[model samples]
Structure formats: C-alpha cells, structure tokens
Target chain A: MSATTLTIQRVSPDAIARVIDDAPLEPFGLTDAHRRALAARLGAITTDHHRRLDSWLVERGGRVAARFAWSPLAARRLLGSGGFRRALRGRAASIRDGVRDEIEDLLARAASGRAHRGSLGDWLAHRHPAELALVQASAVEWARILAETGATVTGDWTVASADAYYDVERARTTLRARRDLLVLDGEVVVRVRAGGPTPSAGPGLRADLAAAAFAHPDGRAPRRYVGIWPDAGVILAVDGTLANVRAGTRDLVRATIALHRQGELRAA
Target chain B: MTPTTTPARSILEDLRGDRSERPPRDIETAAGLRATLDAELLAIRSVPARTSPLVISASDVTHHGDAVDITHATSGRLRGALIGQLIRLVAVGHEIIDPFDDALRAWRLDSPSPTLIAAYADLDANGRARLATDVAAHAASLRRALADVPSAWAVRTAVRARVPLAGGVVVLHDVVDLVVGSYCDASSSTVLLDVTTSPIGRSATSLLGFHAFVHCLRTSVVPLRVAIFSTATGELISRDVDETWLELAANDVLDVARRA
Candidate 1:
C-alpha cells in the first residue's frame, strides 16, 4: 500500500571519532591484548631465520641478494655513476652490515606463515635492496601516520580481529580477505599501500574496499573506505557502496572461474 | 551448444562498449582440431625427445621468431616478474618473495645459459643502471594495475595449467599472468588475464586462442572472457570466447604447423 523512500547519508571523517585508548582499541573485537600477543610473537622472528634467508638469497643471486638490503635511494647514492666494478668497488664482503635486523626478522616471520594477519596488513618482503628498504620505511611511516590519525592498534589489525564487530555471509566462512585498518568503531575500513611514492587508488583498490565491506557478516556496511598511501602521505576517502562490492565479487568470481575452471570441470 | 543456442556476438565490443567489430572467421570443429593436435604431437613423440621433454607453454609456440631482441626479451622478463608480484600481492598479499630478486638469485644457482648468466654477473654499471630504471618503471606499472584489483576476489599469479596432447608425450602448458574470479563449471564464469610490459606482436590473440582450447582440454569448462593489460599502454583489452572462436584458434595453430 505504501513504498517508503530511502535517503542516503553522506559519511564524513568528522562523523567518526578517533579511539585512542591504550587499553587496546578492538574495532572488530580481536582483544587489544591478543593482538599485542600476536604482534609480539611475529616480531620475535629468530636471528637464525634472518641469517638463513639473507645467506640463501645471496647464495642464489650472488652479491645482489645481500647487497640489495639497501633502499633504492640509498643504493643509487652508494652506487655512484661510474663503471660497474667501480660503482660496486669495495661493495663486497660488507665490512659493515647496516640492513636492519628488525626488517629481516619480520620477513622471516612472514615467510614462515607465523606473521600472517589473515585479514590485516602484511609484512611483504622484496628482493631489490631499494624495494626492501622502501617497504621497511613505509611500515615505520605508516605506524607514525596511524598514531597521528587517532588509532592505537595499528600494529596488529584486521576486519576479523576478535575485538572487531562485523557480519559475514556465514558463521563457518573463513575470511580470505585482509583489511588494513578499521576505525570509527569499525565503521571505516582502511587499506594501506606503502613502498614507493604514494600512488592514487584505482579500480582494484576500490573493488577490494567494496568486497571487504559487503562480506562483513555483521549485516552492517562500513561508512567509508579509505585508501592511504602512507609513503606518499596521501589519504583518499570514499563512500563505501554495495554496488562496488557486487562488482568486485563479480570480477573475483570471474577470475576464479578462469583460473580453476579446469579442476572444477574435472570434478563435475 | 549450437549457434542457435549461443549466437556469436562481439565480445570485445561488449566489454569495451565500442563498435569495433572484426569479421568472424571460418571455424574448425573441436573434434577435428583435437585430432590434428594429437597427430602432430604423436609425430613429434616418434622422434627422441631432443629438446625439453616437459610441458609446452603458449610462449614457446607464439614466440618462434628467430631474431632475439635483447631489449624486447628483457622487457618481457621484467614485465612478467613485476606483474607476477602485483598479482601475488592482490591474491596473497605481499606473501611472496620479490620474484625479480629471486630470479637473479636462481640464475646463479641454476645457470640455464652460461652466456646470459655471465652477462648479468658482469653487467657494467651503465647497463645495470639502465636495467634498474627499466625494472622500476615496469614494477610501478604492475603495482598500479594491482592496486585497482579488489581484495575479495580470488587472485593467482603465474598460474600454470597443463593437458597432455598425445598420451602425455607432449603436454601443452599455459602460464597465465593473473586470473581473477572463481572456477564455476559454466561458460561465462571466469576471467583469464594476461599482463605485458611491452606489447608482443599478436601475443594477446595467441594467448587467448591457446587459453580457449587448452582450458577446454583440461577442464571442459570455458572461461567467460580473456583480457590483456598492456602495462606500457595502460590498456586492458578483453574478449569473450565461444566454441566458434575456440575452433578458429585451433585451426590457426594447425595452419602454423602446415606452414612450418
């Protein structure tokens, strides 16, 4: 007899207040204390693992592997514009090992699967010294930015943390998607990309935000999707919509079919 | 399915929302193409396995040119690695090692080509600088391509699919740069993707053609569409595949054999 009209509301950063509680800000309910434990466990990557990876990479690729622990910027500076051997003159048998042990240790955890957040940020490793350095720097910078932006649980976060609150399509569904950070009481979903100069968010990033928001079993959609290029010091905030999620899911489904249709075909 | 049930339409036009339709070619029957491929593979197996005895990738078939453009090849290598990393980042989230770095490291461990390995090991400063710049540019393009991908989708990098042509004697292998979506045993369910730094001549078409038939042989399920993203041009071109198109590609492969 009657059709109720629905009006959409605009989401603003100001609408959400920053939670800066040291008691551990649990957006999706992964207890702050639990997150600290996970972080501590992951951060405690053994020194032996670092030595192994470093040595292994170097042995496989020669000096580039170990020599590349430097950032691209630093590498260019150290590798002055000269003859190849001249550029690398005395670059061998590094009398001084300057590459941070922390970054390497973190990498060891990631490679071992001990550091997988499942639905949070990643501790990605790179082969290029510059790329490796860039990632390490970005992590530090991102930490600083999040601290400045009114969140305390930046180190170990995801949409599915125990402290987090969200709806999923099913109770038994395992979350394969990862969200960078959750704020505004988990109303805002943030995905971070750091390594080089901060770049703009594109279709892929948008699709990711949409999928993460819709898959939320909490039956509630995130108010906003924020893309942060902490390295570039850029923040792109967009209204999260169901359409993007559906589109993303559509692409995802298409990709899956293409990649694994053969196996499924065999099974069928 | 007959043309009555699934009439051929302009797949590229549908995706790009443009009217650049190419005339459809006479297509060979799937059974006939399969027979031809079987016979060729059988003949090859009659002789001792002189060359590599494993899977035959689309690259081997399409990139049969005699002239090896080092720059072109180098570009492809860098682009492939960068794109692979991007896909892994999207699918697995920075879980993989830097493929480029690892590749260089792998080269040292297994020197497939002594000359190539020596060249790399003894790369002059100028050459190395140029390579670094080129690699960075390609890597950036890959990152850009990946950033646009959604996290909810299932993404895989350097995905390998294989099917033996002649009783496992000659295996036709295909390595896709990236694949998005899930494997539903339906015609229009998946999207097969390829990424290239510098557009290789007729590579997109060849890969798409191989993908259509190889997928059918492997899974009996055809992908919904095939796409190629040229990192150099920033173009994502795509086309939907049907039985007719698959037949045409199979015939073209036969033609290559005939000409040879």
Candidate 2:
C-alpha cells in the first residue's frame, strides 16, 4: 500500500511560455465557443507573465482536467536550497520581474559571504524556517498529487543532507522509484517561482547550468535544463536527458544559477 | 543568672495578656533543629545560582527532508536552553508580558523570583450599577498578581508549609488546573506540590508551560516544587524537583547559545 509518486519534469521556460501561449483558456470541460472566447481573453496578457498564469493541468483525451497554481514562494524557496542550486544556476537568460528581486536578494546574501561553509540546504534550514515550511509543504503536495494520479511509489522522496554527501544523487532518484512507477520519459513540467532567474535560450547557458548543477546538493552530471519565473509568466526550456532524477534536477537547477550569474555580470 | 528578672518579665506579660497551651519550641534551645535549618539554607545557597537540565517528551519530532527529520533528543536540548534562559530572566525580577521577552534583557537573570504571578482581568456584566465596584475588584486582583515579588519570601513560606503559597486556591472558570513548586525544609529541599484542580480545560500547552517553569527552577535558580493543573479539568499533578546540576548545565547552554 505504497503511495503514488509524481514524476515531475522541470519544463524549460521557453517551452512553458509556448504552452501557456497556445493553451486554450477555459475551465476543465468548456464548450468550443466558451473555450474560444476564453482563449481570446487569455491571449492578451500571454507573453511575459505567461508562466505565472501557467498552472498544472492534468490532461486526458486532449482536454485539460485538474489544475493547480504552482506556489511561487515554494518554488523560490526550493531554488534557494542546495537541492535547487543547479536549476537556479542553469538559467542563461532573465526571468520575471517579481521573482528577479527575490532571487537577487538571496544571491546577494550568498555573494556577501554569508552562505554556509557547508550545504545551501543547511543554510536555508537554519536561516529560514517559515519560508522553508512552504517548500516542504510543496514537496509533500507533489508527492500527494502523484499518489492521487495512481502512481504507486516504492520508496520515499527525500533530500540528502550535507552530512550525507555520498548519497546525494541516490536520494533524489529514490523519490522517482517510489511505488515502482515508471519514471516518465517525456517532458516534465517545471513552473519557476517569481524569485528565480530569468529565461534565455543560449549555448553558453548550458555550461553555466552544468557548473551550477555540480554545486547542487544532489551533485550530479548535467543534462537538459530549463528556467522559468512562474510568478511573471515566463519560462526558459532546454532539452536533455539525465542519468536519473538527481542528475536531471541538478542540471535544471544549474540553468537557473547561470541566468542569475549572467544578470550579475550585466549589472557589474 | 538573670532568669529571675528578665525571664520573669516575659512570663508575667504572657500571664496578663494571653494563655498558652504548651511551651513554644525555641530554636536556641533546640540545637538539632537549628543545625538542620542552617544546613538546608546553606546547601541551597551553595547550589551555584545557575544551571538546570531540561527534559523533553516525544511529541516534537517531525520530518524535515529526504533522510532528515527532527528528533526528540534535539528538541529536549533546545527546550533546556529555552527554559534555562527563562529562569535566569525571571530570577532578576523582570516584569514582562512574555516570558520569552523577559529573558532577553541583559543581567536580568542574576536574581529571579521563584514564584511567578500573572493576572487576567475580565469585565463583569454590571449594567452600570456596580460597574465601578467590579472594575475596582478586577484592578485589585491584577495589582496583587503582578505585584513585584522582590524575592522568593512568599514562595519559601509556602514550600516550608507544603501548601499553595498563593493563599487558598482561587480556581478560575477558564483555568483547568494550577500547580505550585518550591524549595522546602531538610526533608524535601526541592519539592513539587499540586495545589488545585478544575474539572475542565486541560491541554498539552498548559502542561508544557508548567514544565517550562520547573525547567527554570531546575536549571538557573533553586530546588523547586512544580505543580501542574488544567484550566478546564482542574486535575493537578506535582513533582518535588531536585535540579542541583543546573549550574553546570547553564554554562553549557551559554556556550551553545554563543556558538549558535
């Protein structure tokens, strides 16, 4: 009687933007005319803040079924942790305005030499209990949603601590292995929070993302990466395959870091 | 040699004003009793003014991350630190609405009162007839409860008597129980005694609050009696506590806080 786990994909900001742009704006089971009218209204503010408007939509038979707004605070908190460092550093471009300030604040604090000598996750935990609670709740929500989707999880999803350095990658992969569910091969949805790096599709961004992924708590090799600012309705999507979820999560995290680094370079 | 004149004066005065059932026990005449009280006071005073260990239950555990969770042992340590600090604050006679805030003041932990008094004043449904009277009564109660207890004199009296030092139990509708703890005589230096109980309004938070109070006594202050009562149910439970090791523990807590 294991619970179902969600095999989530960190969708690139660009791809996410496109999906939001192209999606028919209507509730789950709208008529053709109603969907068309709603689409027209949604198409107006669909460019920059598209990901903020982007939500989780479970599709069945070409129809949007269940939808939930990704928590911007939760996503940003994840980005601040060592677990999301790779995804954060992977971004080669810019993100939404709202998230940009928050990410910058965190980065600035880290750059100011206050970052923990150990892992970022430890730093976040010690410094931000209330905010981190939201991130934890979000992770739990992800597990709950996957369980609801009928994917039986074989093991629990967990983040390895700084003290448990050797088991980093194995930990993330375990989350996906829960209940013996197939790790989805297709695009995994990623909704960036407001306080993350901006989106850009550039070649150099990949290297920066790899570097950030290497620094993540999972500490795995990089693959495809994506960045988004869901709060601002923007997404930066890249395509790649990781050896496992740990590697993938790290690569995706790095992409965000790269974007922030770029922003720092421009400011300097 | 002077018994005929000076001692006769006391006998004559007693005969004229009052009657005695039996001769009073005099400390000067009773060498054993005098020696015992002296030893008890000295032992308490010698218990370096600070340090007490904190005990924690199992409820504080929670999951944190993958392969990470909060443990009861850690929580106990934290609770110890928190209570130790609170004792130090209350010892120095700091008046504060929040005990947590009270501990924040520097040098406030030097001499804290063993007994803490808190008051809640509620308006009665007097339709302008006895409004002033009710209001004055509430104010008087508040003044008495929060009155600055410069020392643990009243607490010592209660402890010596093994009774509620706050006078006869004043049970409240909202309060389920009340507990009182204090240091006593040679027999029970650190004793906890239950004072009163109500039949309703008991909760974990209340128990924890009293536990924290004992924690303060055990660590940075004195041998204490801890009484716990519920606001709703009024059931009371008490423990005569011996926290003589608090002095060493407070040093550890200080070191930890500095590092943290």
Candidate 3:
C-alpha cells in the first residue's frame, strides 16, 4: 500500500487537445474538421462548467452541489449530435421570424428534462451529505466507472479525523488503521476515513481540501491509482477534490509513479 | 530658393520601413506623435473586441468569389500596425477639411518637371507652416474626442477631381472618431476602390468620382481621414481585400459617428 495520493492540476486547452488527439478516434478515418469540432465542443462545455462552477461558488458562498452539474459526456450527447437539425428540420422555413421561434422552441425543449437535476444544491447533497464532507455520490460514480474497467482496488479503507472544519484540511491528517473503511471491486476502491473535518460555515474549506489532497496524504493514494486497472501494477496517488478533478488526472499520476519506479528498478 | 530634392513619394513606404527619420523638434513633439499613434492603434485593436458581438457580413475575395453572411463572433487583439502606417502617411500634411488640397498632396500626385513643382510649391511656405499648426490643433481635437472612451467617431468626405483609372471609384473619407478636438484633424484618408480593376481601361475611368467629393468636404463638409485595419481568415480565409465593401462600411460608420 503506497502512502501518497494522486494530485490534480488545473486543466489547459492544450492538454485537452492532446488528449483528444491521442484517443482511439484516430484509427478511424475521422477528418481533421470533425476532430476539431469535437474538441471545440468539449472545450466549450468545460469552459461553461468552470465559469458556472466558480460563479455558483461565489453566489452560494462555498455551498457546492454534489453532482458537479452534467457530465462532459452527457453534454456532448445532448448538444453535439444531430439533435438540433432533427428538432428544427420541419418547423423552420425561410421566414426569419419563424426560424428564430422554432430554434428557440427547440432549445427550450432540450433544456427542459435535465434542468432540475443539474442544480448545484442538489448535486452537493448527492455528492457529500451532512455525514461527511469528502465522500459524495459523484465520487462514488467515478469510483464505479473506474471499477468497471477491471482495476484492482483495496476496499473498506478508512482515515483519521481531527478538528479540521473542511474536507481539504482533514485530508492532510493521517488516517488511523481501525477507523478507516476501504471498499474494493474490480479496479477502483473507496476509502472513507473517520474523524477529520466537518462542514463549517467558514470560508475556504473546499480550497483547503483541494490543496491537502494534492499536497498531503489520505486521499488519491495507491488504491486510487491501481484502482484504475484490475491487474494493479502502477500505484496512483493524490489528495483532495476527487470528483470534478481535472479528467484523467489519476492516469497522469500513475504514469509519473510508474516512470519513477522504472528508474528505481534500473538503478537497483 | 531652397535647394530641394525630390521628397519621398509615399509616407506609407517610409513608415513601413521604420524610417521616420524626420524627427520631431523636441521630446514633447515626438511624444505627442507617439501618443496619437498609440491611440489610433488602440482604436484599431478595439474593433475586434467590439465587432465580436455584432454579426457582420464577411467575405474572403482571395479564395471565394462571394461573401459569407454568417453570424460568427470572435474576440482578440488584432494586428493593425501595417494598416496604421499607411493611414498616417495619407494624413501627413492635408488640411483639416481639405487634406488633398494641401501641398503635401504633391507627395502622391505627379510633378513632371521643376517648373511644374515650383508652380504648385508653397508660395509663402504657408503649406509647411500650416501643416505643423493645423496638425497640432487636429491632434488636440482627436485627443479630446477619444478621451474616456473605447470607441471614436469618423466622417466620410468626398474626393474632388477625377482620377484617371478604371473599375471602381476611389472615395476619400475622413478619419476623425474624436469629438472634443478641432473641427478638422489631419489623419490618414481611405482611398476606397475595388482593387481587381486595372489602373488603365474603362474600369479605371471612375477614379475621379471621389475628387469632387473631397472638394465638397473642404467647403461645406469637414473632410476626415480614418484608418481601417481588417484581416479575415478561417474556412473563408484571404489576403485580398474588397475595398469597395470596406469603403461602403466606412461611409456608414462615419455617418453613424458624426450623427451620434
């Protein structure tokens, strides 16, 4: 079991571009135009999320919704497909006013179904209830997604709690062996550490949690790393802001650790 | 008689090469010129940010023959240095309302002989004297108009006399987007015309249409010269510019600015 955790970094447009370029879509005969359009669409959605999330944080005064709004995949599904064309085909004509109205109607319809579920308050409750500031339904969802990929995970993990008032701060404290709970299936495992931080009315709690996770221990460690695969070779590591962390950060940590291990082995 | 050599033909060429060797008299004078140049650059750069919201008709004549009327938007710091140089050249010594009537107009006009040059020379050095004083006043007016604002105003003055050319007409428009300065500022003038037409032939015959327009501005209307820097790229990318459309748009913008 590795002591350290995985760290998350802010995402950049260039990094996202590289990710898109490396993805499997390259083997197929997708045109540069198509690739560009997809990348642009993803970038736009990410930008919207960042902006809305920051504003939501400011307006709500540190109360974050659990689900982190819509998933990137869901955004792509809803907006990137031929849905716009299908919705507007028969209704709009050459008449400017008619076309505008039809377009508006189509957008309204599309926005109707998922609007309520995507609220910040509800998402936060789902992700982290009053019981624990760190664990949330979104984090669970991420763990499940990782598990389904057949990664090795150490389940029923736990950690030590302290006077820390935020998830980020509590993440820095070392977890006691007995109080922690670890759950593992396939590649992903969840470790719930007891007694650290509780949600407080004070400001900057989330940011603290985020910093401690990346810089401290107790979160995004070996379990999070090897949990990405069933075979469990390279250890992933990090601390804090598990869900809504920059996508693919776990893999980055795994790659970094793996390179370090290789160098060690060669030296030995 | 002052010993005179053929003055540089085009101020645009000198500026383009970073050879503005004719330095201002003092530090304050040079600083004034620099400040005005900077303001114009800012004005040009602001176009992209402002126009980013507005849906405009864009065309790339270099690649496509027709215009692509789409509701595309963009925001960035656009490059206007090249275009600004050309503009400053056109603005050097023209009168506030009648830039083309000044002795500086000789820079672009043909002077075949010494006799011809003397005939049109500044008889009393009035042209040289008027240039500095008039330009200073104009600069002051421009400064006042552009202060405390992200946008400026402009006016479209007609060009008088027929230019022997073809295809499209070259219109001379004013370049005042500031309101607080003198009534007329000597700025670069836009010679709007379709570049596809040859300098000779029937297409060039309408070159003189703007000459009368310039005359109108000198007398009744204030002739203004403005700088317009534009670059179009993407699926409809092109190095070629359609001066006719730009001229029309400039005219429209000028009217709007003056009225406001």
Fraction of true contacts kept, per model?
0.00, 0.00, 0.00
Worst 10 residues of 3 chain B by lDDT: B71-80
* Candidate 3 C-alpha lDDT tens digits along A114-186: 3255443233233211111111111222222222221222132221122112111211221111111123311
TM-score winner among the candidates?
1
Models ranked on lDDT: 1, 2, 3
In order, the Cα lDDT scores of the candidates are 0.43, 0.27, 0.24
lDDT of each residue in B186-227, candidate 3, tens digit only: 222222211110112221112222221222222211222221
Candidate 2 lDDT over residue span A1-268, tens digit each? 2221122122221233343233222211213343233234334322221121111110011122345333322343433233222222443121121123334455566777765655443344343322333233233222222221111212222221121111122112111110111112111222223222322222222322322333334433223333433212223433332222323333333333343354456569
Give one digit per residue, the lDDT tens place, for model 1 in A1-268: 1221112111112211222121122222223343343234323332211111111111122122334333323332112121112212433221011123334555677777776563111323435443443333223223323322333233333332322222222121111333445664556655544421112234344444434543455434455555544322234544444454444334433333332444445468
Provide the lowest-lDDT 10-residue window in model 2 chain A: A52-61
Give all TM-scores, in the order shown: 0.41, 0.18, 0.16
State which candidate, 2 or 3, has the greater TM-score: 2
Interface DockQ per candidate? 0.01, 0.01, 0.01
Question: What's the residue-level lDDT of B27 in candidate 3?
Answer: 16
Q: Regarding lDDT, does 1 or 3 come out ahead? A: 1
